[model samples]
Target chain A: MIGFIIERIAFFAAIGGAGYIAFKGFSAIYRNIMLGRKEKLAGNLNTMLLVAFGQKKMFKRPIVAVLHFIFYVAFIVTQIELLEIMIDGAFGTHRFVYHLVEHIAPLRALYVFTVSSIEVLSLMTFFVTIIFFIRRDMLKIPRLSSIDLEGWPNMDAHLILLMEINLILNIFLMNTADMAVSNGAYGLWLSGIFASAFAGWDVEILHILEKVGWWGHLAGVLGFLMYLSISKHLHILLAFPNTYFTRQTPNGYLDNMESVTREVKLMMDPNAAVPESTEDGPVKFGAKDVTDLSWKNLLDAYTCTECGRCTAQCPANLTGKKLSPRTIMMKTRDRLEEVGKNIDANGGIWKDDGKSLIENGYISVEELRACTTCNACVEECPVNISPLNIIMQLRRNLIMEDSNSPAEWNGMFANLENNAAPWQFSQQDRFNWAKEQ
Target chain B: MQVKEMAEYAASGETPEILFWVGCSGSFDQRAQKITRSFVKILNHLNIKFAVLGKEEACTGDPAKRAGNEFVYQMLALQNIEILNGYGVKKIVTTCPHCFNILKNEYPALGGNYEVIHHSTFLQQLINEGKVTMAEGGLFKGKTITYHDSCYLGRANEIYEAPRKVLEQLDAELVEMKSCKTRGLCCGAGGAQMFKEEEHGRIRINEERTQEALNTNATIVAAACPFCNTMITDGVKGKDKQASIKVFDIAELLAAGQGLENIVL
Candidate 1:
C-alpha cells in the first residue's frame, strides 16, 4: 500500500512539472506571435488537409517522403496508446484496456489489432529514427549540416532521434515483459520473439523489469513534451495551424500597400477626401523587425522544420549567392525570440534599442539583395512558408524607409519615377520602335 | 507604322477586339520590336481588330514593384490604369510576360481590372478558333525546336500548355529542355534583374539555363517573353553557338510558318 501511494505521487509530480514548463513555453511563443500585424485567414481547411495532413509537398522526394509518412502516422497513432498509459499510471493499473477487452467481444479483437499494429510501427519507428541519425551525423547531408544548423539546431535533431530510439525500445521492452508475465496471445507476434529470451527468468524479475520500462517510457514522453517548445520539433504541433493560415494568393501576386495606395488615389482624383493627420504612430514603410511583419509570418517562423528544403531549391542559393531562405526564417524567429525576452524583462512594453534586425547584423543587406524573388523557396516549402515574402518586406524597408538601395536599383527607381520605364529613354519616345516598323 | 491609337479608334466610334499592350521592351528595344511586329502581323492576317496605346502607353511598373520601389510602382500603375480605364478598354494582349503578369495579377488589386492575355496564348486561341492557319511544310517543319519556358509565363501564370500547343501546331518537332514548364529555370532576367548587373555568383543563371537548352540539341530555341528572348540570345552568343542554335519568339516562328514574314517588316 505504501509502494502504491509512492508510485501515484511520483507520477502526479512528473505530470505537474512537465505541464507547467510546457504551458509557460507555449504561452511565450503565443505572446511573440501576437506581436505581428493582423491578417485575415481564409481557405484554412483545404490548406491544412493538403499540406499538413496530406504531406503533398513532401512527396517531391519519394523515398524520404515514404519513410517520413510512416513515422508521422506512427507518432500520431501512438498518442492513443499514450493516453492508455497515462490512465494506467494514474490508477496503478496494468493494461487498462484489458478490462474493456474482457467485457466486449469486438473490443478484444480491436485491442489485439491495435497492440499488434503498434508493435510493428514501434519497430518501424526505431528503424527510421536510426536512418535519420545516420543521415544527419554520419552522412552529414549538406541541407542537414548547413552552417545555420551548427550548434543547438544540430544537437536538437540528434537528441530527438536518440530519444525516439530510446522511447520505442522501452515501449517494446515493456510489451515483451508484459506478454511474458501474462502469457497472453495478444501482442504476442513481435513481443513473443523477445519473450522467449526471458523464458528461464523468474516471473518476479520480469515484473520488476516491466515496471522499470513503464516508468522510464512515461518519463521520457513527459520530458519530450516539455522540450518541444524550445526545439525545432515544435513543428510537430504547429505545422497544422501554420499551414491552415497560409497565404492563398497566387505566388506571383504582390500586395499593394494601403498607405501608398491612398496617396496614389489622391494623385489620381484631386477631389478625393484628404483625411486629417492624427498623432504620429510609427509611420514606417515595410518591415524593419518582427513587429512590423504579419502574424502569419511569425507563425511561419515557428513552424519551420529546419528541413532546408527551401534553401536547397533556392535559385539564388544554388547560384552561390549569400541568400539562404532557411536562414531568413531562422533569423526572423531568433529576432522574435529576442524581442519576446525584452518585453518579458520590461513591463510589457518595448523600449527602443540602438540596434535592429538589419543594422544589428541579424540579416545583412547582401543577403536581402541576393534574392531574385524567384518564388522557388515559397514553392518548395512543405508547410507553405514564404521566406520570399520576408525578404521582400525587408527589401521594402531598405528602399522606401531608408533610401538605402543598390546604385543600379536607385537608377531603376529614378527611371520608373521620371520616364515611366526602367530605361533612360523618354516616355515620348516609347513608341519609336513601333514607328520604325 | 499603321498602329492606331485608342483615341483614334474611339473618335470613329469603333471598338477593337483587343488592346495591344506594347510594353516598354516591345516599344523600345530594337530586337523586341520585331516580336511586336510579328504578333501584329498575325493579328492583321486574321483581321482581328486591335489598337495600341502607342506613345501614350507607359511602363507597367513591374520593375519598380519587383525592385522594392512600391511608391514608383503605384505612380506608374495609377497613371496607366487611368489611361486604360478612360479608353474603356476591355481586353489586352501583350508579347511580354512581365506586362501580362502585372496587368493580369497585380492590376486588379489596384482597381484596374481587365482581361489580359499573353501573345502566345492569344495566338494559340486564334489558331484554335480557325481565325489563323498554318501552311504545310513551313521553314521550321521537320526541325527539332525546343521551347524555353519564360519564368513569368510558365511558373508565374501557369501558362505551360498554351505556348507548347502553339509550337505543336507547327510541323517542327517540339523538344523540351530538362527544366521546362512549371520546373523551368529563370533566364536570369526576371524581377528587374535585367536592368542591374547580376550579384556576384559562381555562374550566371541564364548560362546554366542555356546549357540545359544546348543539352537538348534542338536546332531552334523558341521563346515567348521579350526578356527571355534577350537572355537566351545572349546565352547562345556566350556559348559561341549562335551560328548553330537560333533563338526566335513563338510569334516570330508562327509568322514565318504562316508565310507572313513579309508582313512582319
Candidate 2:
C-alpha cells in the first residue's frame, strides 16, 4: 500500500514537473525564433544539425566526443524509458513499448543493445564524474586548482559536480535494480559479476531490495529533472533549439550587419547619436548583461553542454592566451545573473555609474578584444555558438563609444578613413595596378 | 532594409542591358581595375553596350557599415542609388565582389531599385552564349594554380562555379585547397577586417588561409576579390616565400584565358 501511494505521488509529480519543463522549453524556443531577428535562421538549422545532433564537431576530440555521444544517445533513448515509466505509473501498464519492441526483432535487439550500452556507459560516466569532481575539488587543475570557497561557492564548479553526482547515482541505482530483476538466473554480463556477492540473499529479500532500488531510481530521476531545468546546466532545453536553428552557413561572416530600423531607429547623422556612458544606461552596443545580449547569444550560453569542445579547439586557449571561449560564455552568464538581481533591486547597475561594461569589471574591454574572429570557436562549438560575433559587436561599441580601440586597430581605422585601405598606400595608387599594361 | 530588395530589383522587368557601377575596389585597386576593364571589353565584344558612372561612383560605405558605422553605409548606399537612378541606369554591374554583393544584396534595403550583376557572372554568360572564346589563350606550361573563393562571391552570392569555370578555361590545373567552396576559410580581409587590424588571437586569418593554398603546392594563387588577393599576396611575402608562390586576380587569369595580355590595358 505504501509502495502504491509513493508511486502514485511520483506519477503526479512527474506530470507536473514535465509540464513545467515542457512549458519553459517551448518558451525558450518561441523567444529565440521570434527574437533572433536575422534572416539566416533557416540556414543555421541545417549546419547546426551536423554539429549538434550528428556530433560533427566532436570528431576533433574522438575520445571525448565518443564518450559524449554515448551519453547523448543514451540520454535520448532513455526518454522512451521515462515516458514508459510515466505511462505505466499512470495507466497501470508495466511495459509501454513492450508490444512494439517484441514485434521487430532487430529493434528489440537494438533496444536491448542501447540499454546494455547505457549500463556500461553509466559505469564509465560514474567514474568520469567522480574524477571530474575530484580534479576540480581536490587536485585543483591549473586554472582553479587552489581556490576554496565554502558558503559562497564557485557556482559553476559546484553545479557541475552536483549534476555529475546526480546523473551518476541515478544511472547506477536504476541500472542496478534493472540488472537484479531482469538478470534472473543467467544475469547481466557486467553487473551480474557485481551481483554475485549478493547471491546468498533470500529471493524474497532480493525482490524487496529490487523494489526499493527501483523507487530510488525514480526519485533520483525526478530530482535530476527538476534541478536541471533551473541550473546553469540548462543544455537540456537549449540543445533542441540550438540544433534545430543553427546557422545554415558558417557564422564567421562579420559582413555589414543587416541594418535594424524596426526595433531601434538608426540615426544616420553622427551628431544625433545618443551614446550610453555607463553599463546601466540604454546599451548602444555590446551586451552589458544577459538581457542586453542578443537573445540568440543568450540561448547559446544555455545550450552549452560544458563539453569543453570549444576550449579544447580554441587556438587562444591552447596557446596559453587567457581567452577560453568557454570562459567567455560562462562569465557572461554569471555576470548577467549577478547584474540581473541588481537591475531588479534598482533601475540600473550604474548611478549613471562610472563603472561601465569595462569599468564595472563585468566584461573586461580587453577580454572582448582578445578574439581574432577566426571561426575556430564557431567551428568547434557543439551548439554552433558564435562568440566572435558577440566579441565583434562589443568591439564595435568600444570603437564608437569611447573612441577607444587598441593602437593597432586605430591605425587600421585611420588608414581606412584616409586611404580607404589598411596599407596607408596612396589613394591614387588604388587604381595604378589596374592601369592598362 | 533586406537583401531580397536588391534581388527583386535585379529581376525587375525593365533591367537595362547593363549598368556598370565601377566599384571603389575596381576604381582604386590597380589590379582590380585592369580586370574590370577586361570584363568591360568582353562585354563590349559581346555587343553589350553598358554605361559607366566613373568618377561619380563614391564609396559604397561597406567598410564603415561593417565597422559598425551604419550611418555611413546608409549615406553611401543612398547616394550611389540616387546616382544610378539619375542616370536612368536601370541595370548595374561591377568587378568587385564587395560592390557586387552590396549592389545586388544590400542596396534594395534603402529603397533603391536596379538590376545588378558581377562582371564574372556576366563573363560566364557571354562564354555560355559563345560571345567570348577560350580557344586562343596562353597556357603557361610550368604554372600550377589554385583559386581562392571570396566570401561575398562564394558564401554571399553562391557564385563559385563561374570563377572556377573562368580559370579552367585558361587551361590551368585548378588545385583544390582543403577548405574551399562553402567550407573555404576567410582571407581575414572580409567583414571590413581589411580596414581594421585583427583583434589579438592565436592565429592570423590571412596567414592561416594562405598556408592552406600553400599546402596545395600551387605556384600561383588565383583570387576573385582584390582585397583577398592583396592580403594573400602579402601573407606569402610576409612568410618570405614569395618566389615560390604568386597571387593573380581572376581578371588577370581571364586576360591569360583570352591570350590578351597585350590588350589587357
Candidate 3:
C-alpha cells in the first residue's frame, strides 16, 4: 500500500515536469530558428557544425577542453539515465535498461560504474562552475571579464553564483536521494544508501520521502535543461555548427574577396546577384547591425561560449593592444541586442540611438584601424568566428561613407590612384628593385 | 606586349597551344625578365612556340585588390579581361602566382574565363614529356638549395610540388624549410604590402620566413613568384649575410639548362 502511494506521487510529478521542459525547449528552438531565418548566416552548415558541434575551438586550450568534454559527456549520459529512471519509476516497469542488466551481472556492474562515473563528473563540473564564476567575477581574469558591460554589476555576478549554487544543491540532493533508496530494508542496491541513512525512520515515512526526493531531482534536471536552451547558454545550439565549418586548411591562406567587377556591378545594379548588393555603396561593408550579418555570423556570435580562446590566441591582445577578439564579438552582440530591441519597436535601424552613438563611440574608428588583418584571431577561433571580416567591413563604411579615416588611408588611395600600387614610388620604379639585381 | 597587342598577336593565327602573360614583374624586374626571356629561349629550344604579351600588357590589379581597395582592382581587371577576350586567348602561362591567381580565380568573377598555368607547372610538364633536357654543365648543378614557396603560389593555390619537380630535374639537392608548402609563412610582400610600408607587428613576417630558410643553411634560395624572389632577397640582404646566400627565381635555374651558345645578356 505504501509503495502504491509513493509510485502515484512520482507519476504525476514526472508528467508535470516533462510537460514544462517540453514547452520551454520547443519555444526556444522556434524562437532561435525564426531569428536566424530573418538574417543570413555568413558560413555554410558543414563548416559551422565542424567547429560548433565538433568542439573544435575549445580543444585549442586543452585544460578547458578536457573539463568541458567531461561535463558535456556527463550531462548527456546522466540526462538519458535520469529520464529512464523517471519513466520507469512513474510507470512501475520491472524492466527498462536495468532489466537487461539484471540478466547480465557484468552489464549491471558496468551500468553502475557508468552512473557513478557521471555522478563524479557532475561533482567536478559543479566545482568547476564555482571556480569559473570566481575567476570571471570576483578575481577577474582579463580574458574572461565581461566586455559587454561597463564597471561592475555586483548583483549580476551574485545571480550567476546563485544559479550555479542551485544546480549544485540539486545535484547534492539527488545523490543523497539515491543513497537513501539504496539503503532500504527491501534492499534494492540503487536505493540502499538512502534507506540506510534513515534506518531509524519508519519504512512508510522513508518511502514517502524517497518519492519526494525523486520528484525534486526530476524538477531540477528539467529546469536546468530548459534554462540551458534559452539563456546565454545558447552556445549549446552553436557548438555543433561552429565545429563543422572550421577551416581544415592552414591560416595563411586568404579568404578571397569577391571579384572586383562583380562587387562593383552588384553595387551598380542591386538586382544582379545577392553578394554584389551586400557590398553596395553607403551600405556598411563588414558589419554594422546584427541584420547586416549572415545567419552564420549571428550564429557565431550566439554560439560564443566565452571560452576566450580567441583572446588567448590573438597576437594583438598578447602584445598589449586594447583589443580582445573575444570581447569584440561580445561587444558586437551587446550592440546587436541593444539595437535589435529599438529596431523591433521603431521599424527602422539604430539611427535613433543618437548621432554620437553611431558616429563615434562604442566601435570607434581607432579600434577599426588597430586591427593588423593578420588573421590570428580568425585562425585561433575554434568556432571559425571571423572578427577580422567584421573589422574589414566596418572599415569599408568608415572609408566609403563617413570618410572619417586615418590620413594614411587617404595617402594609400592617392597612391593607388596615381600608381597601380599603394606606394608613393613612381610606376616607373615598380621594376626598380628588379634592375638592381 | 600590351593586352591588346598580345591578344591581337595571339588571335591573328591559328591559336598557339599557349600564350605566356609575362607580367610586369617579368617584363621589368630585370632578372625576372631575363629568366623569363630565357624561359622563352628554352621553349624555343624545345620547339614549343609560344606568344608573349609585351608592352600591351596591363597590371593584373593584384596590388590594388589585396590592399583593401576594390575600385582600382575592378577597373584594371575589366580592362585586362576585355584585352584577353579580344585576343582569342584560351590558355595563359605566367611565372607570377599573384597574376595566375588573379587571372585564374578572381577574373572569373568579372566574367574572364581562360585556362591559366604557372610557369613552374609548365616546366615540370615539359620535363615529364621529355621535351627538355639539362646539359651537364649548368650553373646550379652541384649546389644544395632550398625553395621558398610564394605565398600566392603555394598557400593561395597549393602549387607546392611543381617548383620542386623543376628543381629536381636540374639535379640540385632541394631542401625544405621546416615550414614549407601550404604551411609556409608569408614573405611579407603579399597583399601589396610590397608596394607599401609594412604596418608594425611584433615581428616582420618576411624576416620570420627568411630566418627559417637561413636556418636550413642551404646556401641558395629558389623561388617562383617575383614578389617572393624580391622579398626573400631583401630579407637575406637585410640580415647582412648576403655574401653567404644567393636567391634565384626558378626560371633562372631552368635557364641553366641552356648551353653556352644559347646564352643572351
List the candidates' TM-scores in order: 0.96, 0.72, 0.69
Model 2, span A236-352: residue lDDT tens? 557767777665542423443333322222344445444343234443644343454566676676666555555654444544445667666665555545444454457534223
Candidate 3 Cα deviation (angstroms), residue B115? 2.5
- Assess candidate 1 and give its TM-score to the true structure: 0.96
- In model 1, pairs of residues that clash are none
State the lDDT of candidate 2 residue by residue for B208-245, as single tens digits: 78889999999889888778888898889888878888
| Prediction 3 global C-alpha lDDT | 0.63
Which structure is stronger by DockQ: 1 or 2? Answer: 1
Clashes of each: 0, 17, 53
Q: Write the per-residue lDDT of candidate 1 for residues A1-437, one digit (tens) a residue.
A: 99999999999999999999999999999999999987777757888999899999889889999899988999988887888899998999988886658668788778777877888898998899988888887898889988889998888888888889878988888888888887755555688778888887889998998988888789889989899888888888888999888877778887887777777778868787756443258567888999888899999999998999889867677777788999999889888999998998889998777667775768888888877677777878888899988888888898899998888888988887888878898988877775674
Question: Candidates 1 and 3: which is better by TM-score?
Answer: 1
lDDT of 3 by residue, B52-116 (tens): 55544567876655545566667677777777887777899998888898888778767789999
DockQ of each candidate, alpha-carbon based = 0.67, 0.12, 0.13
For each candidate in turn, the interface RMSD (Å) is: 1.3, 7.2, 5.6
- Which is the better candidate, 1 or 3, if ranked by lDDT? 1
Question: Which of candidates 2 and 3 is the stronger one according to TM-score?
Answer: 2
